[model samples]
Every structure is written in structure tokens, then in C-alpha cells.
Target: MPQLSVIVYGPNTQGHLTELLDSLDAHPLADAEVIVAAVGDWARETAGSHSPETIVVPLPDGTGDAAARAAGAARASGRWLHFVHAKDGLPAGAPRLIVERTAELDAMDTPGALAGPGAPDAPGAPVDVLLFDHVSTTWQTTAAPSGDGRLLAAVGRAGLPLDRSASLLRTAPLLGNRALRAAFWRAHEEEFTTDDEPYAACAALLRAGRVACLNQVAHEKRVLRPESLPPLAPEDRLALIDRYESLLALTEDRRAARTVLYDLMVRDLVRTFARENLPDPVAREFFHRASLAAVRWRPEGHQRPAGLEGVRHSLLEEGAYTRYRAFQAANRTRRAARKALRSRKRQVSVKVRDHQYRRALSRPVDPHLAVFTAYWDRGVACNPAAIAAKLAELAPHIRRVWVVSKENAALLPPGTDHVIPGTRRYWETLAGAKYLTNNVNFPGAVVKRPDTIHLQTHHGTPLKRMGLDQMDHPAAAQGLDFAALLARIDRWDYSVSANSHSTRMWERAYPARYTSLDHGYPRNDVFYTATAADVRAARARLGIAPGRTAVLYAPTHRDYEAGFTPRLDLAALADRLGENTVLLVRAHYFYGGAASPLTGLRRSGRIIDVSSYDPVEELCLAADALVTDYSSIMFDYANLDRPIVVYADDWETYRTTRGVYFDLMAEHPGKVAHSQEELTEIFLTGAWRDESAAKARAAFRRRFCEYDDGRAAERVVRRVFLGEPEEALPPVLPPEERTPAPTPEEATA
Candidate 1:
């Protein structure tokens, strides 16, 4: 019979095993045999060094905690079993108290699985599991401590907080029928680590018999090492809240219920901010779902939480009234100040300082083909470098490539003429361009131009609310005045660049302008052909270790100046993957000079700030794995074929504030790592290199970039200049027809 079992999940630290053993050895009943189930060999070795008497069980590579625990249980022979992690320690007085409790329960009139003092000041003596007091001001540990673990909430009202006196009988009936436990665990193990839902379910099932807790503080839970898990995603919040609601439905203890609800609500608030700042469509979708869940809203179920009614009355209505009043006040003030401020003239178009525009216009326009580059917002996605390179590729023969941008000279590819004026001169700019191209939505409609070819190269294939399929947003009258803009868009602009997973969404969102072109930001072609040697060179230039796998984290900056203080757990992540993985932090161009508060991270030689990488090409090429919440570059990274992890830990508030164009959770092409631990697992395992992942990558290429043979610029020129349309573009090979690129030796043959 196993007296104690410690199940250590990876990538645990070097000293982690030592800490677990020392605590167990110090326990009052130190004579009890210790069983160690460790996933990684490093942890097992560490545990063995601390106590040779310890029985070391090596967990298989990919097995989860639940499965590992069951494996350990099967091999154990201790009279009582206690499960824990390498990082956790047993309570100071736990061993002696467990024996005493066992004796006391045995002598009692009715011997149950649990026998101990219960809730304080109740009609009866203290209940077995001591639940948290509703008014307790201390930060409550919602999840149970690993050492001397007991079944809480699931068995009864009181949440079992194991301290010195906490004990479980481990009797045959309490251990649950062997076959039943195995079957139940096998069926549900996959869902356990996903979120709190599986843990909640386990508690609900009452697999372990009546459990009890000691009111006295037993174990001092250690602070969580950083990088343990990826931060929570917006979707995670909704799932957690849903789990809490289900848990509440089962348990009768109001105090326990309130504690869970408080935690849920606080997490919901944090998630709201995360979504608002994510730049990608998928992240936006994550935000949309989380926002709906924050107020306990289920769009499909038509069920709303009772607490939402109060929110409707107090927050929503009051906010609307305040906004309206503020608007009225501002209007009144503007009217009175209008005459006095007459001398302040509106902003005019900026004058060019050089002869670049004149030289470009004089180059001449051929009627055979006209190229128009139009931009509505920040022109970063247009990949100015590639666009310039493409135009230069066609400069000798192709007639014209007119460039228009919302902000004049906003990242115009060099040698392209015609900078579109800002919002005030939008109509003027549209009229000047022979061809019109814009992404997502334009500021306002423009009169259709004659002989003008309209080609819409939409910015990206994001998965949040946007265009036609928006689920929730303020009335259209509010932002940018969509009605006027839609009416004026050039119907002839019949093309859009559909990136990965975008084929289905682009067609549905913009049926008219759908060309399904295989071209994304042409400048990314630079990275598509970038060599691993180039990555190494870039790292050397930056003075970072060449051996370390670079983790590039790029978070989009908010346009409204709404500060998003991202709490990245860098130290924790460094500790997990050892010292080999390096973190490169890059903020959006808009974040310009704002300093990141997540300091002291650079001291570890593990995390570095590379946001200064002007064009983002070097950073993209050097990164071994890309971790981002939302930024359009993910579309470009598809060309690299490296591991991609999305951190949309915040999804709700982002939708309500910024809005999404599509659903990221459903449409994204890679794994979603809502916590750091999951992210670290991916980094260490090269899990993205698996066969299934390769298949997904192939599918991704087929969907968005099938013709990427490093000849995108050449292909575009041939199609546009040589009068070739669909046939000019290379046909996407079927999966069976595809073959890996030959090595240099094979290519020479």
C-alpha cells in the first residue's frame, strides 16, 4: 500500500524535486514510504537523489496528470494514498494528524470515510470538510493544494482544505470500485488539463468517498513559478464561469459558491481587457465569446444569469445615460466656442518635400494595365517593402501603379506616385487613382470611376466579428459611417488576398470582391525565402544566443490610446523550458516609445526586447516559435511553417470595445495556448512537428498560399502584365501530388 504519491508534471525546475522530498520527509509520519511518479527524467533523478527509499515511477512522455495518478495508484501498496506534485509540499503536522483522525473515526459510533470537525458555529459539531467563510478577507486558494489532497465541494458543501488534521480513509468503498474508477478516468482524462471544467466534473462525480478538511492551516502553498501556463484566454473565462455555474447547481454551501463566483467575475474582467487589445480576427472572436460569457450570456442557449439583471439596471443603463449627457454637454460647449475658435483652421494635406511624386507621375501610364494600391488605415499589412519590390519588378514594362493611403505617404512603397490624403481628402484621393483597393471597410463611399479597375486586397483573414457576419456591435451609425462608404465602393474592385482559413470566410464576407488570390503582403516574400542561416546571423547581430529557440511575442497596440498593461509571465516561462528558449518582445508600431513595465526580464538572458526591428522581417525569420494574441503577421508566418501559438487570454472586453471580424477559436490554423504551461509544453516537445500538424500546415497552404514558390512577385507581374488571369496563377497541387522540396543534391540531379 502506498502511503504517499507525488505526481510531478513537466517542465519542472531543477530544485523542484528536492523541495517535494524535503517536505514529505519532515512530515510527522516520515516512516511512510514515498512513491514518485515523474514525467521527465530530470525530475525523477532529482527525487531519487533526495531519498533513495522513494519509489520512482517514470510517467510516459505525453500522459496527463490524471492518467499518471491512476498508473501510480495501481502500483501502490500503501494503506493510505496521498497525491502531490514535485513543486508542492506536505503540511507541517499532516502525518501525525492523519493517524489521529483515523483512530478517532474508527472509535466513533458511525465510521464514515470522513470523520473530523466541520463548519464552525453550526447547529452540530464542525462538519468534515471545512468550507471557506463567505466574509473571509484572505486570498482564498480555489484549487486544492497538491499535498494531502482531498475531494472538496464535489462530495459536500464544505470545500475540503487539507491542513494538519486533514485525512481520508482510503477504504475499498472510498477508493471507488477499481473498474469504475479506471473507466471513468479514461473517458474524461483528456478534458482535465483543458480547464477547470474537468476538475469540477471530478468533484461532482464524488469518485472519492466523503472527504474532510482540517480548519488549521496545514500546508503553506508556494508561489506559482512563472511560465507555468499561458495566460487565460477569453474563451477560458466563459468555460470557467460555466463550470462554476454547474458546480453551484450541485453544492448547497452558499459560502463556497460565492468564493468561486468571485474568482470567476474577477477573471472575466481581466479577460475583457485582453480581447480589446488583440489585433487578429481569431483573437477578436475569442474576445466576443468571452464578453458574452462575462455577463453569463449564452448566445445559443438563450440563457442569461440572474446577476445580469442588476448589471442591466446599474451599469449598462447608467453608462448610456451618462454618455448621452456628456455628449449633450460637449455639443453645447462646442456651439458656444465655435465662433471664438474660428481662427483655428482645419488640418490641410501635407505638402511633399521632394520631386519623387513628379518623377513617378512622369513615368507614364499605359492603358493595357493599371495598378492601384489603396489603404484605409495603418498600412502595415500592405507590406510596403514587398509592394515596392513588386512595383520595381514591373517598372520597366507595366504602365502604372498608383498608390493611395488614408494618411498621406503612409508607408507608400518607394517609387510609387500619389499619396492619398487623410479622411478630409478621401474623396479626392479616390478620384485620383485609376484603380481602387481597400481592406475590411473604407471610411465612406466614393462615386464609381470610369475605366477604373477595383482590386480589394483585404488586410487579413482574421476570425473575429467584421463585415457581414458581425454578431454584436453598436449600431452602424456610430463608427466611420458605414452606410455612405458601402454605397460608394467601386464594384469593379473584384479581387482580395485570402490568407489561410480565409477562403471560406472571405467568400461569405465579401462575395463580390472574392478573387482568392495566393498573394499576401508581397514583402513577406523576403521571409518566405529567408534561410535558417539568416536567422542565426540575425541572432548573432542582436547578441542573443544562437542555440536558444526564439519565442517572438508581438501584441498589437490599441488605437484609442487605451493602455493595455499586459502581464507576461517571462520568469516563469524561462524556468519551465530551461534556459534554451529566448523571448523576443515586440509591441505594435503604434506602441512607438511606450516602455513595457514587465522589467527585470532582460536580466535572465532568457527574455529580450527586439521591437526595434524596424521592418519586423528579421524578427519573424529568427523566431523558432511565434506566440501572439492578435497581430496580422500570423498570416505571413504561414509561409515559415514554424510552430505558432495564439494567446487570446482575453476575448470578451476586446469585442465589446474594439470589435472582431471573425471567430478565432473556430477558424485559427494553429494550437491555442491560453496558459503558459501549455505553451512551454509545445516549445519543449516540438509537438507542432507532429504528423497531424504537418497535415494541418499543408491544408493551410492549400487554403491561402498554394502558389508560394518564392515567385509571388513574378507571378503577380506575369498575370497583370502578360494578360493572364486564373491560368497565369499556378494551379494549387492536390495533396497527393505535393512533394517536399528537394535538397541541393537532389535538386542538382
Candidate 2:
């Protein structure tokens, strides 16, 4: 038999199942079996595709999680059983750690070892349950270690019975953090028949002959937003009373266990009563049932907790539902008054603006209206612009308005309807529009309406760490308000991604409930749709000579730097490169209107500054080759099937401070240059366009340019704006089949 059997159970539509399985595969354990209790045909198929070696026990549709887990346990053929939910994942090396710990226990339980001075009564006196540490993650916050570490430390590596560690009951009530011996589980299997994991945990712990603690974090449990979770039925809420009663029976003889169990039961009920929005009848019935349980199961000489909780316990014993309601109402009134006072501290003009915005929000949403913004209202550009252009053709009935800054308003197309920020029309448009789309987040003050659908059309694939991932990299997260960032992310109804890599990274960085649309970036449609003549026109517009090779040098901004300091000496590099080549320098967008440091070289006719240029897509079309370092432009440029050279001089500092998702030096599209000399040598030696460079570029394109097929705009427009189903949306074309636009030289030839 295997050392351990891991059973994964959840619904068919669980989004993070693949991630969990991937984690297990990444950290393989010897002699460990994986069993997937797939609750539906779709889940079975997905599990099979992701992990064919996993033993799949297909449960019928609508089967409860409890039944599915029981089925998996019945099929397990190992010494120990560990359950994992599909949405949760194993930390790195967790499987090996667990298996090693179990092996140590097995050796201690061997026949010859039982006769030792401090040995147990029998050879089978091994630990019945092994509880470990876990981390809990919410949509807004980063993963934080859960459970009482001090309690686990007190138990130490040596085993202890549940009675000795009964205080652990107050720690997180989750089954994912514990492992049960298969034989011990079989003996008390009936106790877990119900769908209440916490009650099952309590029953198992109370009955276990021996329990141990492992202080390492083995599991990562995702805590869904309360509003995002489906509300439990009234019957399910009432069923908690039955589960607690059964748990009380198990703990009747042990005072320590009894006290912990009773306290836990009362705390669970109180939290449910205070937080959940139950019907009036169900609320009263729940309170009455909880009161009877609290009075009957109260341990002799058991003192209630201090302060507000103690008062709540007294009220529960008295069955004072009316008094509880009044108490809660008074507290809420005080909270509201304090909130009003805080609001009044703001500027009078700001308060007036907020009041007007709130009044506008009260109005009914306009179904036919949509608002669009990009790059913090610089103008309509990037994915938002592409989607808007497509909407004009396919969804003209849905009126579109662009949110632009005062300076950018003049850059918008002549007939484009637009509003400046901080204007009455802007607030009204944001409030009334049924569809709100942007590449960047809107103002934090914008309230998300129930009817409004916010689509986050991300501008580019992420290479550097984003969202909560930036928390550890203080340089990248300078003055970033994570709470406010998550609040904006919470407003998203859909997040668009360009490829599977991007989809996975986005999920890790932003753990929200938004649906992921793995459609190619709409902005990249021009890369595939532009013709030879269009390429030529773009080059001409950028003032590039017809036969000269144009190398576009675009570098990302450094968070550690206070200003937009140029990383490379543009004049020196431009002079080193032959007269046959010219450099098109584009600074990072953060320094858009700043004076170019290379203005002297611009007069020399070798360096062309395109920082203020509109529509970067045209710049991509105009360039023959791209040279970038740690910029997402390389990922987008790979779609053109052209040569790319990574000019990374401070790669070590950048990766350490910025926390890149992947090591660009190892997975670059083409040659990597650590210095200007190396960059110049690659061009002079013709290595930039050699066979090795082409092969590397092909591999990069296959990975990063999976969904750009000249029709991404149509796919997004159909799905979000037109409300077309996934089945009806346009399918993504393979990267190998795509043909990029011709270069200016090729077009002229």
C-alpha cells in the first residue's frame, strides 16, 4: 500500500482545481496515491486531462461534497488519508513532509518498539490524527498563516491525545489541515456522513486515541468573499444544531473536550446569527435552538468569555432575541454616526461632489450606455480603444462614451463622444452606464452598481509581479494601498487575458471571483491584420528611411529610480550601430510629456523619439526589430515573428526589486545582452537574425502569442458587449498558423 492517499473533492465548475493538481505534481512524493472524487462528468474529464495517473471516482451530478469524500476514502488503499478541496492547494514540499512524518509514526508503532519503557499499551498505538498548520487567503488580503502556532508548538513533535490539546478546537475549524490514519478513519467513518466538515473534525478529534501536531503550513485555503458565497438554505442553517448535539455527545465524558466543544458551538452560532442574512422566521428559530443547546450543554462551572462576548452568552442563555436585536441596532447607529463624522472632515467641495455622485447613482442604469477609459483617462487607447472600435461596428445600438483628461480630449477623434474627468457629465455617465470598461482602474470613489458590468481589459501580459504579489517587493509597492487596489479589483465582472500563462498569473496575483476571458488582447489585432502597405505607411509616418533597419528600443521604468533616467546611452549605442540602422526610442509611458534626454541625438538623425506618439500599435508595425529589457512590449512584439534582443544591464537589481514572474534571462525570445558592447556585437555578427535567433523567437511566440489571430476584438466584442455565449464566440487561431504584417523593406520589395 502507498504511504498516503490524497483525496481531492469539489464541484465540476471549480476554477482552481488545475492549480491544485499542478502543485501536487510539482512536489512529487514517493509512494503517494492521488484520488480525485469528481462530482460530475465535466469534473472527471478535467481531472483526467490534467492528471491521468490520478484514480478518479466519478460521483453523479448533484452529489454532496460529503458523499464524494466518503466515496474517495472508501477507495483509498493507503495507511493514511488526507482530504483536499479543489479550490485549496498544497504548499511546496508539503506532500513529502507529510509522508515522512507518517513513516516515522509507522516505525514507532512496529511490534518490537512497543516494549520500550514509555511505549503505549499495544503495537497499534500510532497517532490517529495528525494536525498541521495552514494559510488562509482572501480576495483582498495576502495569504496569512492560520491556526494558533503557540498551541501547535506546545504539542511539539511528540504525539498527544486530543484531551491534552483540546484548546486547539478554538483554532481554525477546517478538515484540510488534518490527516487521519486510514484504519482510524474507517472505525469512525459514519461520523463524517454529514456535510458539516467542522462538526466532523470535532467528532474525530474527540474520539481519536492519539493526536499529533505538525507545525509546517501544508495547505492553502482560499476564503471566498462573504458576498460572493452562495447563501445556505434555512434547513442547512438549522442542521447545525443537530451536528453540534452529536459533537456534544462525543465530548460528554471529557471535561476539557466538553468545554472546548461547547464554547466552539456557541461561537459558531453567534457568528452566524450576527453575520448571515437569514429570514425572520428562520432567525428566530435558529436563536431558540441555539439557546436550548447553550443551556443544556453548558459545562459545570464553565465561565463565559469576557466583555461583549460574555454579555452575548448571558443573552443567549436568557433566550432574549428582542434584546439582541435592539443591541445590534444601537451599535449600528453609533457606527453610522461615526462614519458621517469622518465623511464631514473632507473638503466642502469634495463632499458636494460625492453627494451629487451618490444622487446620480440612485437613478436607474441605462442599458444602452457604455463608458470606456484607458491609461487613467489619457484617451481611448489599448484594449479599450480596440473594443470600442469593434463595438461601433457590431454594437452601435449600445451608445459609447470615452472618459478623457482635459489635455487628451483634443487627441480624441473628431466625432468621438467624450467627457473630461471631474465634470458632472463624467460622474453621471459613470453612474448610469450599464457597461464600464477600462485598461486601468477607475477612481476609488466610483461605486459599483448591481446592474453595471465592469470589464477589465488589461493592456499587456504581465512579466513583473502584480497585485498582492508586490507586497514583498517594497520598491515596486511604494506607497501602494493594497486595500484600495483590491476594492477596485472587486468591481470587475470579467478580466481579459491574452494566453493561458497570463490567465494563470492573473489568478495568482489577483485572487478575485471575476470570470477570466482567455481571449487575445484586442490591441494586438493590428499585428496580424495590417497589410504590407499599412506597414509601409506606418514606417513613413514615423519618418523611417525605406531601406534602413529600424530597431525599436523600449525599456520599462524602474520603481527604485525617482525620475525617468535612461538606462542606456542612446547616443553611444546609436553611433556604434551602422548608418544602415536607426533607433526608434520610446520611453516608458510614465514619462509621457517629459522632455527627451536624447534630443541632441535626434538632430544627428540616428535617434527618433516617439514617446508622445499615439497608438503604440503603429510603432510596433513600423519597427523591423525590438530591443527591450523587462518590458511587456517584448511579449507583444513576439507576435510579429521578428528578432528581439533583451538589453538587460541591471537585470539582477530589477528582478530582485520588481519580482519578475519568470526569469527573462533564461527564457528570452532572442539574444540577451548584458552590456552595450554585447548588444553591438550581436548586431555586427548578424546573430540577431540568425537561425538560432529565429528558433528562439518561434518558441517565445508559441508561448506568449497564443491568442492573437487578427480577430481578438471580435471575440471580446461578441462576448461582453453583444452578450454572446462562449460557444458562439470566435475561436482562437494557433500561433503557427498566424502571419504577421510584412516589414517596410518587404513591403517595398
Candidate 1 is scored at a TM of 0.45
Where does model 1 exceed 4 Å of error?
Answer: 1-385, 397-430, 436-447, 471-480, 488-492, 499-501, 511-524, 540-542, 555-561, 588-601, 630-632, 648-670, 684-704, 730-749
For every candidate, C-alpha RMSD to the true structure in Å: 20.5, 19.8
Residues 1-749 of candidate 2 have per-residue lDDT tens digits of 99999999976544778877876764455578899998888787778886566888888888987898899998999889999987787765566557877888777653432221122233445677788777666665434556355667677877766677787776676778888888878877887666888887766677676678776566778777767778767757888888888888877567887898898899988888888888899999999999999999999999999987898888998899999988789878999999988777656668778888999999999999999999999997999999999999998999999999998888889999998999888898999999999998999999999889999988788999999999999989989999999999999999998888999998888888899998899999999999999999988888888788899998988876432435565655676687878899888897665434433336345689887887888998898899999889998888888899999978999999999998888888989998766888999899998999999898888899888888989998899878899999888888767888886678889
Each prediction's TM-score against the native? 0.45, 0.54
Q: What 10-residue stretch in candidate 2 is worst by lDDT?
A: 112-121
Best by lDDT: 2
Candidate 2 off by > 4 Å: 1-346
**Between which residue pairs do clashes occur in model 2?**
none
- For every model shown, the clashing-pair count is 43, 0
**Positional deviation of residue 502's Cα in model 1 after best superposition, in angstroms:** 2.3
